[model samples]
Target: MFSDSEIPFDVIQAYLETHYHVHGRAPTTLQVGEANALLAALHETAGVACSAFLTACNPFSQQLEPPRNLELQEALAESLQQRGLRFIGGIGQHPANGWPGEESFLVLGLALDDAKALGTQLGQNAIVWSGADATPKLLLLR
Candidate 1:
């Protein structure tokens, strides 16, 4: 599994190539991981479906105290410990706790149940995408 402290420049590419065994082309970002929305949802609920938490930060979006809190972290940690899901490379500067940005991506771990919960919580703020399971699509700040 990939460690949060040691993500390579071509980390995502390497994961795809190694796991999928089909390295057709490399991507600028990693799109083969879990979604940010789902991670947020699980954090909000504090449920058992919580997968690993892959911090995604950029120059734009930053972390807040309310929306994401210590309780959420505990829940995520507990849930992930139970599940077999592994935390991989993130989409921002800090792989552990990245800052947020507009269009910035956050790579999080989530099970199917967690994704469903996220869909319900998102309601209007987020969208349901089928192409990739959990890779966040991040954008840069000025």
Candidate 2:
């Protein structure tokens, strides 16, 4: 078993790519952001060191309209809350590139199992690479 800190960004990126390839579609910007946020939340909830990268973005982007985006955020929050996870929201410069843009994001701290369950519920794949020594695990949500 590997700790969250042991997971590398390259590993995560690889799985993310695999997710794209296997699904025959790349995750939307929103999905990428959400996945990162979820990973961060999971680490926080587990009291483990969170190495996940996070970014902020406009809550209302062109990809999603106002009410729908708001609804999605609310639904994700409610789901996490019901699962005993804490949601963290923030607005800041992009953590990865230090881009000069203020954005909003919601992250729910969850354990691996909880993350998998949530992904399943949302029709997403929770792909995680535990460590260099372990094989990547893909949890399909359909």
Q: How many Å off is the CA of 104 in candidate 1? A: 11
lDDT of 2 at 117: 53
User: Measured by TM-score, how close is model 2 to the native structure?
Assistant: 0.37
- RMSD in order of candidates: 14.1, 12.2
Give per-residue CA lDDT, model 2, range 1-142, as digits (tens).
2235334555344334432111112211222323444343344454654221122122211244445545765676565567664444533332354333332333323345655554445433233322111222443332
lDDT (Cα atoms) of all candidates against the true structure: 0.32, 0.36
Per TM-score, the best of the predicted structures is: 2
Candidate 1 structure quality by residue, lDDT tens digits, 1-142? 3334223435333323221111112223333343445444434444333332232211012344634434443454454456644433322222332233212212134544454443333221221222223343211111
Q: Which 10 residues in a row give candidate 2 its minimum summed lDDT?
A: 19-28
Off by over 4 Å in 2: 1-46, 49-64, 90-109, 125-142
